[model samples]
Target: MKNPKPTRQRERHNVYRRVREKIIGLDFSPGSAISENELAAALGVSRTPVREAMLLLTEEGLVEVFAKIGTFVSRVDPEQVAEAQFLREAVELASLRSLSTPLDEEKVDRLRDNLRRQKETGEDIRSFFALDEEFHRGLMDLAGHESSWSTVSAAKSHLDRARMLGIRKIPELGRLTEEHHAIFDAAVSGDAATAERHLRSHLRLVFADVKAVEEDSPELFVRDRDAGPHRRSAFVWD
Candidate 1:
């Protein structure tokens, strides 16, 4: 019989990424119970791999396990979101500072193209989110800080979720797109001070969004542990 090691490893990795994406994308819904048996069946894998993936997610603070209660997709933690926002802003602002006069025409054109695409996305929240990511990564690349963006992306899962929540609350993403344009304009003009200011303000906007969302849907966020357990039904909106 062929060794099952390679197959098992591949299954574990697939399950890990799939589960992580669902949680980060809010597919599973925050604070919702995650059933190991159901997930295993859905993935057509044994419980071992699913359980292993859950363990890794728990370590990442994306999932929580309560003794005898069950495993759950962890609620959005504003503190964690704030920390990610701070790191992202620092790195992006520093990147902006690295830019020199006479920005590359090719790179500037690329950013403009990205903005055009962002406008075309209209009210498609998921599409807008994807383009939003591409636009930021494009800026990092323009500033010769492409490698740093990977680090930022990996650490900003919480921030991404919060941004999504914000999108849901807001009427449209036009303001965010305009903010991107302002930052891009400053960068292309080689105005480091102006660029840094715009970028700083843009990055910090997530906190206000978080506050609005938390006030609207308090159940979707993490509450104090001492307050005791309260499991609210997960509500998924299209």
Candidate 2:
């Protein structure tokens, strides 16, 4: 028997993308409640699709639904952010190591172009993050590990919010561009080990910067110091 395609599924996906962008851009800030009715109205869609999209986002850990309180953007957990960074570094370094001598020129150019766009974007954090993802994905593609790139991309969402906050305060635009240039040079020179090392260091450095922001901006963070030792553990990274 041929199964019928679900028409609303496409609409749900569109809604999800729109809402997810808002969440990542911090338009829907952490712990901010959003009503399904209001969202549907704003998106010019029915409630069914909005609900479906919200459910999908909730599964992705991007949104939280409280029974009585309503749905809200999930707060960034520092521990989750650290774990995501660890996963990204592990996959990225492994992919880099697998690359032999004589790196691909096309991939190198792609990364260079991404960095150029990143620099030209200036303080536009959303555009910068998109280019940053593309830059890393280009390296992963060069290593012939598209699936690995997908895995790392999925894990990076938690780190995205933290990164957005960190970059806003720290002005990492120039530093990030320099780091990418360094990694690009190492990769194109066929220095796999050096490239992997630089990539790992870059991930760790960003994590440290994010942690600093969490400490400095307590109000922006959802975790409260008065919440006890659990909160401390959440923020502490190995």
How high is each candidate's TM-score? Answer: 0.83, 0.85
lDDT of 1 by residue, 1-238 (tens): 2556554578888999998878878888887877777788888999999999999888778888877677888888888888888889889888899987666788889899999998888899988888899999989988888889988987877778888888888855999999999998888877889988988888878568877788787777878855444455353322
lDDT of 1: 0.82
lDDT by residue for model 2 over 12-130, one digit each (tens)? 88999988888887877676677888788877889999999999899878877767557867778777788898898888888888987666777778888887887798877777778
The alpha-carbon lDDT assigned to residue 169 of candidate 2 equals 83
In order, how many clashes per candidate? 0, 0
Please give me the total number of clashing residue pairs in predicted model 2.
Answer: 0
Task: For each candidate in the order shown, give its overall lDDT on alpha carbons.
Answer: 0.82, 0.79
Highest-lDDT candidate: 1
| Candidate 1 runs further than 4 Å off | 1-10, 67-69, 101-107, 226-238
How does candidate 2 score on lDDT?
0.79
